[model samples]
Target: MNTRSFSFRLLAWYTCLLTCIFVLLCALLYLDLSRFLEHNVEQSQVRRAHQITDTFLATIGKTGPSYVAGQAKALYEPEISDRFVRITQANGPIIYASGMPKDGSFDPAEVPAFPPVSSRESFHRVKLSNGKTLVIAALNYHGPGKTSYVVESGALLDPAELNHLVLQLLIGLPVAVVIITVGGYILVRRALTPVERITRAAEQITQHNLSERLPVSRTGDELERLSISLNRMIARLDDAFQNSKRFVADASHELRTPLTILRGELETLIENARLDPEVRERATSMFEETVRLTRIVEQLFTLSRLDAGEAQAEWSRFDLAGLAKTTAEQMSLLAEDKNITIACDAGQAVVVEGDAARLKQVVVNLLDNAIKYTQSGGAVQLHVRRANGHAILEVEDNGVGIPSEALPHVFERFYRVDQIRSGEFEGAGLGLSIAKSICSAHGAEIEATSVPRKGSCFRVTLPLSKN
Candidate 1:
């Protein structure tokens, strides 16, 4: 469960995007509700003002100012109470007031001065210290004796509808988000299920199992298309690997018998008393080359079997230290020609279960490489020890060490470093690759480390035997 995995990261992105969208939608809803409430409240107040002004003007000249006021109050007082109402003289004296402070007064400055409304009253919202919201309107009103007055109407904001909108937002937003997020994760997981299956199948494949193909999906979507492509690639790789194994086996079998006969004939010819000295020397050189070719062919055959999983390890519990010492003693004779020192540290008996002959090949190859690369007067050391229940076999050389770039590919088949490829060194470059294959077949690991002009070290780790 990695929190930083692709699935979790995608979910995080979805959540952030959804949250922003949710907030925007919620804000838009709130604004629309506020606007609807304010407009409805203002329009209701304006209509009430029209009724009060018309009734007052109609009765004003037929009766007295006091009479008109009392009649206007009687007819429109109920309507005026729900919303606050006020009437004022042109000089700004309050003539009538209701649903406001009992003093029957409002601040004249609070009234917005707009051109007298011929058809509609101009409205504005005012906030009072008491935490009440009111929509106030000012309209022109004609009174008795050519006197004019301003009729101002106030309406309380409709809170019931706005509160409903608030409740909907508070309750619905979280529920919607939860539902959408859960659904998004499920959808994403379903979408990635093929990838997970592909990964699991790929993990099960190895060199021995290259023939296995990934399960191809038929959904015809991108994932399905990817699966088909990978299956085709794996099929091609399996074919190539099989062809390589077959070629090695076939070539090795074909060349070894002829080379054996050639060697025998050369040996016979060189031994003849009648042979010319110069011709004998040439035959000797040819014999040496034939021997090298035979060795390379045999190595290639062994590797082919290893790759095809036909080479079975003959496990035995043997003294690994003894094996190391014996291999070093044999390699020392080769080292002597270059005047290099070969030191062995195998005083302890570290026993391990493996094919002794194959393990011997591993040691021989490492020592061979060390001796070949080390300069005259250089040193090669072989140490066999048990560490953490495993046998550690180390071969170190003080020679022209591998360059940093060449170290990694030293064990790869036929991979010669640039210097070696320049004809300064003699090898087909199959020795380390063969050694690595042998180690792997025995369930062991071989690793190399080096520095330019410093030296190279090879370590082989094998599991210690219980016997």
Candidate 2:
């Protein structure tokens, strides 16, 4: 069990509360039961004392005290029943006294004499020498001819039934607690199942799938309301994202015609032999900048299309190794300008399903990025291989590698490392972002890892074609 999880904490609190309740209930029950048993014992002694006073004491004057004693001995058999019975005249002598009980549980001689002048019946408890308790009840009565007498009756207080109850509670409490704990945990897990499902669904929803919504259970509870609220929030986010992509696509499309006219007019000016050399040079610089801006706009259009699921129109099976070889060869000319070496390792053919043109553009972007950052005499290597039912393409370069802080944002649109933001590196930072968007459209993943000043490696993994 994870102790920090919500379920664990809830169960811990529940168990603590349940244990406290059980203890409290058991304590109250034990106290109530003990008192009830003691009360019953005292009441029984009072009833026995009443029997002697009502039946035997009525005939004390008629038959005499000695006769009354014989009748008591014959009827009650106090010695056999473990009972103490005594009769005496008020402020006079004892009429009758019981002998030692058969069980010998307590000594009759240890019992104190009843008070001679007690106005009413009374009850008390006595602890005998044999570690037994006795509940004694005494009564004063007036007989015929104005004669008065006292009656006393008592019995040992036994705790056998209460002890059995305690023993049963001791044996059953732990088992009951264990059963309740297991059942409670299972219920908690079931209650949270819907939340877990919602979490997994939310994780799968990205910018590309902004239309997707979380599953909502119609349980008429708080979880149901929460899911509905989150879906509404996601719908708003989806609207914002779609609007942003539409704006980029529209702006890029609008700029294409003017950029083309600008570039063509600059070319026409440069080609005129009668133009001044300084004027031609200035036109050439503006032409280069216009071309760079044109490329950035094109890439923005491509990214917007990819985000709108419009880029994977021509899916087909193709050899990834062959594509890597061809793209590396084409980019080698660009590497040569910087005196950088380009190497292609395409020993084995790895077939994958995707738009071959888009994949080739990915290769071109990665090679171009490597060549731009690598120093003179540095090397860039491209390799394609098959592994675990996937085609892997790696473009590694011995270049001024990305800083650790900037590595994560390498594939983000318009994100450039601070080290490579100089005028010498002419780029708007959209190449890698376009490559990543293309890969995502083809159900592939791209990752970049770099150590500053050491090297950088970009790896693309795509599912191998079944054919």
Candidate 3:
């Protein structure tokens, strides 16, 4: 705490700026007070000195030379104390002194030393023989021709008052500084509390606890928004971790089938005499499984590319309708084995920009999925058309369709609609996942519609080229 925090820095800057302003104000105040006090002393003392001279002139104006020093002293000394009073004839030598030095003498050589009087200013400094400084003032009682008395008088300020003023300034400034620093620090800390809380939350996060989320409060500030963002990132990471685990398990399990067949074929060949029909039959089954394994391996590679965003769709204007007709013709042979008919309801050639090979893959995967599940005499049909500024392709079948619960996950890598314990007869379950990825890369949307024991259909919509 003594070393200071972010809040303390903010407070220190704020207080420094305010303290400078306060010091400037205090300096101005002291200057104004000095001017005002000096003016009061000069004007009052000068007025009294002029009054004494005016009295002497008035007597000379009336009785003539009757007003003397003893009468003047009696008239003014009680009214004004310790004033250095002197009267000169305009610019001439000293004529009278009512409040001057005692022991009868007007010594011109022993004149008091003082700063020169500024007529423009009311106050001037004068030094007594004792070295005490007095702020003094002078005035001419009358104008030149009959000019009689130039009167002067002043008072010395007390040293104790000056000392008190200095002490108060020193003590007051430090107290003000402390108050400002403390109050400013408190306010800054309250304002930045949210930021500190966010820092603590980030520190607590670890790889083992990705499920943990940052705490968000009613303060819907920027820090709260940041917490929300962190929580979402953590959730996505958790999902990806789980997906990675499932991918490894499913890949290993799928490869076991082909590997088991190969091993069984080799075992038969090793344990029995060669050139036998039954042994040859086992070899043929193993060979088919090997071909299936190669296809699955290729699909896995495609999935890896799709996830990494390396599977780029080549944009080309082509006849989607013609492509559908050709793809249906190709899949018809596979359908024929199960007494299923493959038909194409090809609309007019709708030219679209998309990856030709990937779109062909989408059609082929749909056909494969449809024929694989369809019973004898069931039909698998391919439909291509243009609507809503898009080229829509659909594959529909009359077969044992997918359950609604499993349909959502059918496009996930290695996810099986019929779990492995039941439908090991079907190939690896990356077909629809490939179809989904291809559609995505082409900037198209794909969806599945299925009814349990009824039928399943997948539709893909691609944007039609405006040109």
Could you give candidate 2's per-residue lDDT for residues 1-467 as a string of tens digits?
69999999988888778877887888888889989998898888788878887787788878899988998899899999989888888878888999999998899999887445556777878888888888888887888877788888888888897888788778777776886689888988898999999999999999878899999999999999999999999999999988988999899989989999999999999999999999999999999999998898888888877877776788888999999998898888989988999999998989899899989989999999899988899999998998899999999998989989998998988888884454578788889999998988888999999998988999999999998
Candidate 1 C-alpha lDDT tens digits along 1-467: 68888988888799879978998988998999899879877777778778777776456567655765675567767343555667766665566665444333333245444455555356777775456676887777667667777777776666788789889988998998898789889988998898999999998987678988888888888888888888898889889888888988999989989999999999999899899999999999999999889888888888887786644567678999999999889888889999998999999999998788888988999998898888899999999999999999999998889888888999999888885343777888898998888888778899999987789999999989986
Q: Report every candidate's CA lDDT.
A: 0.81, 0.88, 0.73
> What digit string (tens of lDDT, one per residue) describes model 3 on residues 18-105?
8998899878877776777667777888777667666665454554333545556577662255556655555555655644434222
Q: Global CA lDDT of candidate 3, please?
A: 0.73
Q: Quote the lDDT for 14 in model 2.
A: 84
Which of the two, 1 or 2, has more lDDT? 2
Model 3, residue 226: C-alpha shift (Å)? 5.1
Model 1: what TM-score? 0.75
Better of 2 and 3 by lDDT: 2
Q: After superposition, how far is residue 112 of candidate 2 from its true place, in Å?
A: 4.0
- Candidates sorted by lDDT, descending order? 2, 1, 3
Candidate 3 off by > 4 Å: 1-5, 53-57, 63-68, 78-80, 98-122, 127-132, 143-145, 204-467
Q: Which structure among the candidates has the greatest lDDT?
A: 2
